[model samples]
Target chain A: MSNKEFEQQLQRSVAQLTKEIQPQRDLWPGIEHALNHEQDSQPKSNSWAFQSMAAAFLMIGLFGWLGFNQMQGGDRTEQLVTVLSEPYQQQKQRLLASYANQPALTDNWQQQVQELDDAAAAIKLALKEEPDNPALLKMLKQVYQQQIDLIERVHAPAWQTI
Target chain B: MQTQGQLVDAQEHFAERAVLNLIEAVKAGDKQAYQMLYQQHLGQVYALCYRLTADRALAEDVTQEVFIQLWRKLDNFRGEAKFRTWLHSVTSNVCVSYLRKQRGWWQRMFNLENSEAMHEVAPGSAGEVDLDSLVQRLPERARMVFVLHAIEGYRHEEIAQIMDMAVGSSKAQFHRAKQLLSEWMGYEQ
Candidate 1:
């Protein structure tokens, strides 16, 4: 084949390529986590390395230490909040599935979730740039907990009937 | 072709405007605007990383790393050129620097992949020539050159500067990539 023909063939093949290839996994979550984790420590520090395994339970510990004293006897709302905040993936998945399909009692849940999603995306992006900031990590966790609480609160049948 | 060119120009103008607005927001420390930019440009960033590394996992890491660097370096952008152009330059630098650092003298000579992920995908999945599989099989320098030049529309001079190689070497690697691509495509046909 002529060199021009070969070059054309190369161009044809290359042009057929898509400019974007979706990753096999959703990488944003990891990116967000990494950014936050790194921000809590030095660029080369291993201090926040444990954060990968320190998901929802970190909040559980925080909430328990902070506000568990306010509640008297076994408050179901507080109890369910603790359960919703659990970090164990398996248990959390099973627990969430039970309430995943229920109709929300509140009308604004979708908008609330959209706001949380946007907040989370924005936090992750910032975390991508600045990884060791404790304030950002706390904010990210709080935003996440608010999302969980919102979901649980909306679906709690005893609280409101819609 | 003319219509396509016009369409590309229009899209570019629109993107330039969006990027200008985003850069202003980001400069004011608007993290959300930076993320908006991330979502807008991630596909191309990721695609460049994957094509550069030829390993899916590494590409993901590289993609994240590029954006992280971009976030830190966002202020350096003077807006003289399109943001995409600036981002592309950053992506290229990060990927190439990574490959250089990861490759030891012997590894570069032997042309070994940093990870075994490349071999995980079969050469002919679903009974057709997998161009990705073929591209991954390419020798490292040639693959990078092919991606930058043929796929990304980079001139040999720009590639030479980016790869820190002679202009003639860049052209040679590009040719080598095409020759191999033709061979693989021919075999499939």
Candidate 2:
């Protein structure tokens, strides 16, 4: 081919090149997993702040509940706990399953989760003693929300931050 | 009734609006929105990565990394440029960074010499006369310059910035890429 023809052919080939080529595999699943894993691998110092925040929320929630109980009366705590805990547990299970393969951001993330679980169990026990107390029910709900938030922040922190 | 051109324009506008909405939803921590964005852009992103890296596996990894980083950095996108343009820039940077990390210091120092062997081991090496295959045979720097400039419509100056080379070097690499590709395609000077 002449020089001009060679240049023309190269331009033609470049123009004809496909701008999109699909991968042989579905990459979304792996990407999704990595997104979760990336958040779970953030610095450990964030974990300390997370734990402190959860503790403060719980303390505030408990004090607020105590004061509220003095002004309220109800026997629906057991039923309400059942309503909240059942769905919370199922959602927690799904979240855990979704992030099952990811390593936690901190060494003690699992322990932190366990601590929340223990706190929830203890709150449930307190609710049993005062099954009529709306305050205990409120505490249970707050604890459950905190657990969910903790799992979420660890797994997909971008969502939480925004 | 709308003319064909007007209809096409309307469709393009609608598509742009939908992508903008998806970006907003993704910024709000919507996983589904993010996934939609991924599905929409992955093919183009993968194509750029694949052509730039000339390796299928590395392209796949780079594609994933681009989307993963996109999720974290979506908040920074202030809608100043078209999302596709921003994403193309992001994908190119990620591919470059990934390539840098994959190569050892010695290989980077001798990148031009070492990359010539990449053509030998590159997939579809035997009897494939397609332009892409020929592109895969290009040395790394040359391939990147050609892909970014010729295929991706980037100016030599932009490519120089992306690759951290002088504009003259970018032009030289592009010329080298075209010459090599022409020789492989059985075109004479």
Candidate 3:
């Protein structure tokens, strides 16, 4: 057969074949059913991955908020502690500095003796106000011993050289 | 011929619009549009499943599953390629998985019809030629390549990408399928 005839034959065969294999109308119902089934089964927010992600996000957010609140609370607590404790720190510093220059024996230690007298007077007043408190009594005793030690030590002669 | 062209064109336009409509409806969980969309593409999807699995029941099952998946993934369809191509790709993947799960060579090759069953079906075309039977007779790879390239009108490159074969292999398969078809038709060299 000629090339033209052969080409025609080939085209005819293809055309006929395409028509013959075209899917039946009845098959569409099953196909549609499959499509619906597949659509139903696809991954959605209902799936485990999505649920897990949402749960993780919620947990992280809760922890983050808690941490933020605690951080703010800590800052406030530190500020209050500092404000309440500042005067006590200052009083302690004055007491400590006044004793720095006292010697074992001094000709006239009147200034050193006066500072100790004032501190002891302040402690006595505070103890009278809070009479039953052991902490207050303990502090009062510490101040008394410190004053007596300062005076006694100053009255003693300078340390003897070995 | 003109009517067929008109019908195909109308179907194409309808399919495009229907898909867009389905996208909106599916997002809103509209069952009606989903059904409409499924009806529109069912044949193509099932044909793909049937071709890949070679089992009517399995193809039906896979087709069902594929459509459900397609509905859920409608948002993911970026309109980059034709929706049909996306559908076919999904169908092919589902069939591959089913075949793998079945783990039998015969199942992989599709239920080869017994001679008696084959004889029962009348040829719809002249000269006792039934395209489906002829397609079924092709080697798995060659048949897949043929259906994708010739019937489905996919390019060799696209077929290669979809089938995970080299482009040359796809082209060779197409060439082999054409030659075989020509032989089946008893076309003289």
Candidate 4:
């Protein structure tokens, strides 16, 4: 037989090929299980973010108060720092617990919060040498507020926009 | 009254619309709608997977992976192309990736001499051969090129892109596939 005739026979056979074939077993159960497993593990994966943020905030508050005592300038600075941080730490813990089940709106919100905590720590370290330094106190206050704003923004009801 | 051709067209249109609705529901996170879509397309996806992988068990695993990926990526479909076309593209990519990950299995099967690869002869006259069985017997690249280009209606350019080879190589593999298939079918030059 010529190549042309052979090609025609091949084409006919190709055209006759079935487009669908049923699998010997049901595959949907496996796929559904995988998808559900993914959904179930999502919150557990985000648990690390919650832990990191909580640890960062605790360190900043602890370091700030410790620095106030080290300076020994006056009891007023220690009192003020304690007043500012005590309630803030309580609120932070509450918010983290409440939002533990919810996925964060942003991937790097925890990182941003950690950076702010680092800034707060450095300011507190400076305050240790000059406890009455108003500029450093203001800066520390700004950092703390920024952390609160970030946490609130990430878990806000309007998070869909973010 | 509609003509027979018109009636068939209307039915097809209705089916197409139903599939689009299911896609929209799936994008909205409706699991039932996704299951409906799965039941509707599993056979077609499995067929592509089976032909591409050339192994029943591997095909089953690849088919499941394809659906899992479909669930994750259904949101990316912008309706610019027919869903089935997009799905076939997805299945082809998944099969290629899955096969690449199972390179050891492919190496074992590639040695067709030791591999009990082509045992299912077509159930017909003694000389009649199943094209799919013959395709499974072809060298891996040749089988992939022929299946994509001839059976799946992919152009050599598209096959090259999908298989990550040069277009010339795609054409060469296809030519080699045709020659082997013709020879296996007992056709002379």
Pairs that clash in candidate 2: none
lDDT per residue as tens, model 1, A32-87: 44434434324212322244246545656766764656653335333433443355
* Superposed model 2: Cα runs more than 4 Å off: A44-162, B104-106, B109-129
Model 4 misplaced stretches (Cα beyond 4 Å)? A40-162, B104-127
Task: Give per-residue lDDT, candidate 2, residue A160.
Answer: 21
TM-scores, each model vs. reference: 0.57, 0.63, 0.48, 0.61
Arranged by TM-score, best first: 2, 4, 1, 3
For the predicted complex of model 3, DockQ is 0.05
What DockQ does each candidate score versus the true complex, computed on alpha carbons? Answer: 0.13, 0.24, 0.05, 0.24
lDDT of 2 at A148: 69
* Candidate No. with top DockQ: 4
lDDT of 3 by residue, B1-189 (tens): 999999999999887877876768867878677777776777777777776655575566556556655655677777778777777777666655555433333332234423233334433333445566666656566777887776666788977877778999999987776666555555544
Clashing residue pairs in candidate 4, if any?
A: none
Q: Write the per-residue lDDT of candidate 4 for residues B1-189, one digit (tens) a residue.
A: 469889999898898889999999999999999999999999899999888878787788778778877888888888788889989989888788666544433253235423454334424322455788788877777888888899999999988888889999999998988876766776766
Q: Rank the candidates by DockQ, best first.
A: 4, 2, 1, 3
How high is the DockQ of candidate 4? 0.24
TM-score of chain B of each: 0.81, 0.88, 0.70, 0.87
Better of 1 and 3 by DockQ: 1
Candidate 2 whole-model C-alpha lDDT, 0 to 1: 0.73
Residue B71 Cα positional deviation in candidate 4, in Å, after optimal superposition: 0.2
